[model samples]
Target: MADEYRPEFIRRKFTITESLDEVLKQMADRYYQGNVSLCLRASIESYREILEGEGYMATRRIERQLENLVDEQRTLLMEITSVRSGLQESHRESADGQQLTEPSMTNEMVRIIELLKTTGDGLEFGDLVEQLDLGMHKVQPALGRLVDRGVVTRTGEDGERFTLAGFSQHYLRSGP
Candidate 1:
């Protein structure tokens, strides 16, 4: 019972010529503590080293591929941003054009209408200049156009205030 219960080790058999056996024995003696088991362990270690060196090259190739993909993504993102900026500018122009009764209405005219509708008592020349982000040269011309179109009204003895047109009844009742 004790003999049958002993731990077992697998045994292997190999066939080799007498000359090859001598060479293996010498190699085992030189590097493997003169033991055949140590000789097999050394061979396995050498194979592992070779496989790992090859795997490192494969890993480097995969890293380069990933880097190229990231660069492509960055380029795509920049193009999208540029296209969006241009679209927004054109859309703003088109939207302003739609606000006018006539297609001949300029960007300045659209700005005046939008500004006038927001203020209760209208705006002065200086206020229009500041809010419109334009100079006196540009603002005066646009205001003139609006007056001619009956789209704006100039008030006060000095004509200092400017208000929207078509709201006279409401403005007069809510005055001062």
Candidate 2:
């Protein structure tokens, strides 16, 4: 599987006027043809030489920009993992006996959705039940209903845990 997905990195020289966006686009275009690690190593060495000749101030600025880019990439990766987990859980529940059947969003579910939207994180089942002052049985059914409507999505390997799906954007932006 790993071998099948290996990205090909290409070696190329950058002109003085080329923008970072252009470089990245070129890199992406060539990344699927061979060993990306070698390509990146070569690119970094070239960049280092360029920066050294340019001076310390430019080097430091580029380093800072690279750090910011790395941080942004890390954040996006984390969010993708979270969303994938939620979708996985939702898929698992497709075969489960329990299904969401609440007639309408309860005030508690409304509150839970609001909290998740504001924080961009889902609550654990125990925490949600406690917060809403509801029994597990009641909360489970209500959550199932919300999941069925595509407003909430589960996130754990077990079907019992859930998160607000991206569709909750509608509820958050438009209100109940």
Candidate 3:
């Protein structure tokens, strides 16, 4: 009868919290007695109770921690997105080589015709890089060429805006 007796009955009646404590006690006893199977069973049942219990504050704490973690993750993602956008804008602006502030009018005129012909809609300096794939450094000199040729005209301060000049037709066919 001693050989047939099992300790499984000890796990059936206790509350989750009480059951977990009992299971730990049983594991300690089993380890001393060399009853590995009994120790393993108690450990498994204790885990089941903890997971199924409605009043488990540990679970709630874990969920709150996860939510806070998600919020931090979202904030980091937004920061990365903003930084990437700034870099892309900077790259687009510099793609055309250089600024056009000192370009000769002749070079400016030729560049203007090319810019309009390529874009159809006029281009800003930034747009020039995006549309023409030229660097900003090359843009000014080319714009000067067009300006001197009388093929392009600037209408605003900083040459923020431009128009195909009196000779749009000539440049349109001849290629700047």
- On TM-score, the stronger of 1 and 3 is 1
lDDT of 2 by residue, 63-133 (tens): 99999999999999999999999766654432221222233557666656555564334677888888778
Residue lDDT tens for model 3, 8-113? 5554654457777676567767673756456667667768878788437777888999999999999999999999997566433222322323333344344545
Please state the error at residue 82 of candidate 1 in Å.
44
Which ten residues in a row are the worst by lDDT in model 2?
A: 93-102
RMSD of 2: 21.6
Query: Rank by TM-score, descending?
Result: 1, 2, 3
Residue 140 lDDT, candidate 3, scale 0-100: 71
Tell me the deviation in Å of residue 88 in model 2: 27
TM-score per model over all chains: 0.39, 0.32, 0.31
Kindly report which residue stretches of model 2 are placed more than 4 angstroms away from their true locations once superposed: 1-103, 157-160, 167-176
On TM-score, who's better, 1 or 2? Answer: 1
Candidate 2 Cα lDDT to native: 0.65
> Which portions of model 3 show Cα errors greater than 4 Å?
1-55, 98-176
Using TM-score as the measure, the top candidate is: 1
CA-only RMSD, every prediction: 18.1, 21.6, 15.6
* Residue-by-residue lDDT tens digits, candidate 1, 81-112: 99999756543423222333345778887888
What lDDT is reached at residue 107 by model 1?
Answer: 84
Task: Name the TM-score of candidate 3.
Answer: 0.31
Q: Which residue pairs clash within candidate 2?
A: 8-31, 8-34, 100-144, 100-145
